[model samples]
Target: MLCIEDLLTLELFKTLPRNRLDWICDRSQILNLSTDEILVSEGDPARGFFIMLSGRMGLTRRSDGMEMPIGQHEAPSFFGEIPILTGDPNPVTVRALTDCHLYQLSSEDFLTLLHECRNFEQVIFKTVAKRSRGLESFIRNREKMAALGTLAAGLAHELNNPAAALVRALRDITPALLELQRMNLVYGQHQVDAEHTAQWIKARDEGYETITHKRIDPMKLSDREDELLDWLEDYGVEDAWKLAGPLAEGGTAIATLEELTARWQDDQTKMGTMGLRWLALSFEVMSMISSGLRGAERIAELVQSMKSYSHLDQGARQLVDIHEGLEDTLRLFSYKIKNGVEIRRSYSPDIPKIWAYGSELNQVWTNLIDNAIDAMNEKGILEIVTTPYSDRIEVQITDSGSGIPQEIKSRIFEPFFTTKAVGKGSGLGLEVVRRIVEIRHQGSITVDSQPGKTQFTICLPIG
Candidate 1:
């Protein structure tokens, strides 16, 4: 049974006159809920306005495949107004935490009261605004954290291969250098002729040049390996195949090996094939050093790209090269893009750097590129084009994917609006993009879409 005393417990009900209070008491139905019982679920239709009289309830929203607690409601609290007012589905689930009693007012009756009482309507609208801001704030923070997690994971993946190569280079080079020192000691003991030693030195230097420069044609490398292998076997070297690859990669000729090893053939000591072993080992070391250097350079490149993309060292607003920002974003997303996406870039060579919020602009690029990749399901052509004008610059990102539907195109930039499945999107991505471009940078954005192509164009002031 409903009573005037129960309605008065809430301050909001106190705003109404006696007759209106009586009206609410007559129209509101008593609803009892057991602990853990759901009153309304996220995405459920607007049921009505609810006035909590006793006990507590929990509010949770689905995000990233998990139910996240956004807030709680205690006794003498009121809710269920946001959805009713907005005429939208409930954005969160409400579940009783303890046995509870509440009054559910039909939408029609709530609206009638809202229109009839100015004070009641004022209070309700204020509460609605506060709650909306709170929910938006929580979800926006979650969105930023989620985006950071994704980029961190991608960075780890991209760093792995080169880091491993670097470790292997450091690990293996030490043993090979020690072995080469021992070989040199043995060769020095022989006190071979100066002319003979000069020939070996000349051959080793030439091989180093060839390996470092990558002078050998890959197509011809296999044939060279075969020739070296056959010559080493004929000369009685054990495991001749092991030495062939290094020798061929160094662009070693059969004649050079013959000339260098001609004097050592008759010597029964390790000196017999020492010349051949020395040359192969030397070439292998050179190859390792080259590979290690390349890996280090790649690591440095990725690190620099990330640093530039973040604009950590720069001020909030700086002269930003739009192409650099785009390139950095593409580099970060390379793991996703390389799998199946083809990127086509066209930038006006004369486009000048513009004063803007550099990092925020990068975020705009990140969200758009990320959405473009997903829209293509990781397999399609992503085209980026930049055109410079006297006063402003226009950047376009186009993807070959199923286009945005015509009906929802206008609402695409609205906050909390999304076509992505639940838990797959926060629905704030485009909203953030819009804010950064239009509000923060005083830029404009527009989208054009069709069956196979969707392009988002952003125009920003150069000054």
Candidate 2:
């Protein structure tokens, strides 16, 4: 238990009226944390404030996905009071810097404490307001550095493309290098005459092109080289080397090219199974480039969506189609959905659009759809239906799979409480969805869950 009087010595709790202080003292619970335990994470819903009782805690900001410590709080300082006041997700993650004890008052309990203790509420709000302003300023400065993240996801593709080409170019070198080694080995061992070896080299050189192209007509190639050599002799050329430059030095380069081109003029399939393999690798590289571009494009689009969805560009809200927002959002998630799911839409063809922050509402759709897809375990049917009411448009996203567990449904929208395996989810999604719906669109969201089905509903008021 945390007594208001005991915490009052802390600057953050000092201003509460004695009665108000006692009210807070009555509701707070004490929790113990082991070293390295996570207290709060970035984007987690702010449940209430925490006062570190007897150990160190770290505030970590996730930038470039590196959890750099932004600050540290020692015993007697409170945290999370800022986001609780502003209704935004907690932007910093707080983890135990050492084995520690903490006093926690959940947001639900805080409401009752707040109603009973105006003085305590005022102290918390005043302290958090100053912190909020500072955080806002920090956020603006950090936003600039975020461009590096954008460039990284974008420009990193430059490396992937060249890296993929190198993989192919290396594959082609294997046989050629081996053949060269065999040549030197045989000749160095005195196994053949220089003239015989030169002829063998010439034949091997011709075969390099033929077999690579899998043409392999040894006699035909020998006869063609002979015919070409004979023609050069008719023009008073003797040495094959002496005639080489003149043949190529004149327009005969084009004639040789024409001869080679005629041989290779067969369709790509003429290389038989070998050609199919080469084509497969070539297409694979092309696919890597395409997928990388798509990933980079998606990151850029998310930044755009983030900027537009907030629409700080212009302050006033206006009429927008929720489905249009959902449709565009769906495009961004095409890869995730297309991998293993069937989507069904039963939208009312004529529902009126609602007035709200269009992009923010799109996030609501995105978050819901993301959860619905996850609920299906990435495989099953997803159904979306739009219905018009007297004053609101109701949208339902449903999935066929295991549903939310009953024991934890009440806390599903609470921040940091996710059933997802570590690293895959942060548990902030539904909480963000709740805020976007209630705060931005003045809408309502609810969920109905069962063993093989889970449906999330969104109702946005019409203008």
Candidate 3:
């Protein structure tokens, strides 16, 4: 049923000699496939070269038991050549999308033609090159999307705690302000003596300063709170425990409270009520202000870290502090490391900044540090050490995780080579690191691994 006229339509056969075309047609068998029929399953052994004669076929790749359509083969197109040439299992499943007619050439016959026909070999190799580039381009973009997704997830998690703290601080400060205003009106009405009122204001200001500038020891604070509670209760103050916490946090001494209460000793009701309430409320306002300030600072710090990691407001290539970049990445990934990972940094203060692609260089650090976290499973020590080498700055990132296997170490930097499970890795992370460090920055990266320690060392020129 097949004719040389059908072969003429294919660019591959059109360029081949008449005798060779006849030879290929004779050696190949025709296969008719109905819609939805599978021609070859992924991981199946290579059977032959398939040249599509009519209808369309689709190719789907399986990743983690999920099938994803990657490409298609229409009439006059050919496949199975890559697997045949490499002698590997098929990388994707091929199925007919419509009723299809295909010419299947046995592997032996295909190789014989490859060896004997110069034009045929050239055309096949060209197709291989073009197809390889297309696949790589598609996969590289997917790898970037995957990496961005991971970093976005980590960033969201890292931002949550501080953002929540900021919200809570803002919410609590409002009610405290209203309570302070009510206390101000009451103080004017009570009209205590000027001298004693000045003393109370002085004491309140001092307590505010202590809350703002001093750090309290937890154990000491606990002891002081108990003492204050006992004294307040003995003096007939109701809810004595309510005033203990802020007073203790403000580092208020028992003697100071006693002296402040001396004026109101005869008026026990006032001393136990207004005097105690005023002092506690003053300390509470100061504490809320401090908490709010700290929450805002933390939010700002995270935002600044993200900006630095991205090299915002800067050109692509610039003089970069490698240590700063590493720190920024660590800050961005703190959510992942803070719980169990201990990070130790050793830096050579004299090492100079390097001229390089700033953000891309940061990407190298991100990938290396992220990989280290994964290797340790978030529970080991990670060390970052920088020192001056011969006219270069050397950064060594070492992790206390199970080391890379000797056999696979050499291939770890190869694109599409991964130890991670399918769907978890696009396998381009280390390859991108390699390209950025070596090709883009003209730097060198090397790995040293053993049973419990694995180190990735990068040396960049001081330019």
Instruction: State residue 61's C-alpha deviation in candidate 1, in Å.
Output: 2.4
Clashing pairs in 1: none
The residue-by-residue lDDT of candidate 2 on 1-463, one tens digit each, is: 7776568668755766677677667777878999999988877789686777789998776654567666788987777766666576776788998999888888876667656667767877787677655654554345324423433443344345445555554565555455445545643664444654454344334433433334425565455555556654543333543333322212233243333334334545232222212222332333334444555565566555445444547656767766667765665565567779899999898898667877567667767777777778789999999999898889999999888899998889875456764434555667767877887778898888999889888888886
TM-scores for candidates 1 onward, in order: 0.95, 0.46, 0.89
**Each candidate: what lDDT?**
0.90, 0.63, 0.84
Tens digit per residue, CA lDDT, model 3, 104-194: 8999999998999888899999998887677666666666666566667878887777677778878887887898788778878877789
Instruction: Give the clashing pairs for model 3.
Output: none
Worst 10 residues of 3 by lDDT: 268-277
> Per-residue lDDT of 1-463 in model 1, one digit per residue for the tens?
6889988888888878899988888998999999999999988889999999899999998988999999999998999999898887788899999999998999989999999899999999999999999988888888788777777778888988888888898899999999899999999999888999899889889999998885788779999999889999999999999899999998889988888877777878857587788889999999889888888988998899889988988899999999999999999899999989999999999889999999899999999999999999999999999999989999999999999999999989987778876667877889999999999999999999998999999999987
lDDT of 2: 0.63
Q: Rank the candidates by lDDT, best first.
A: 1, 3, 2
- List candidate 3 segments past 4 Å from native: 1-4, 26-48, 55-71, 86-109, 266-272
Which candidate do you rate higher for TM-score, 1 or 3?
1
Error of 3 at 159 (Å): 1.3
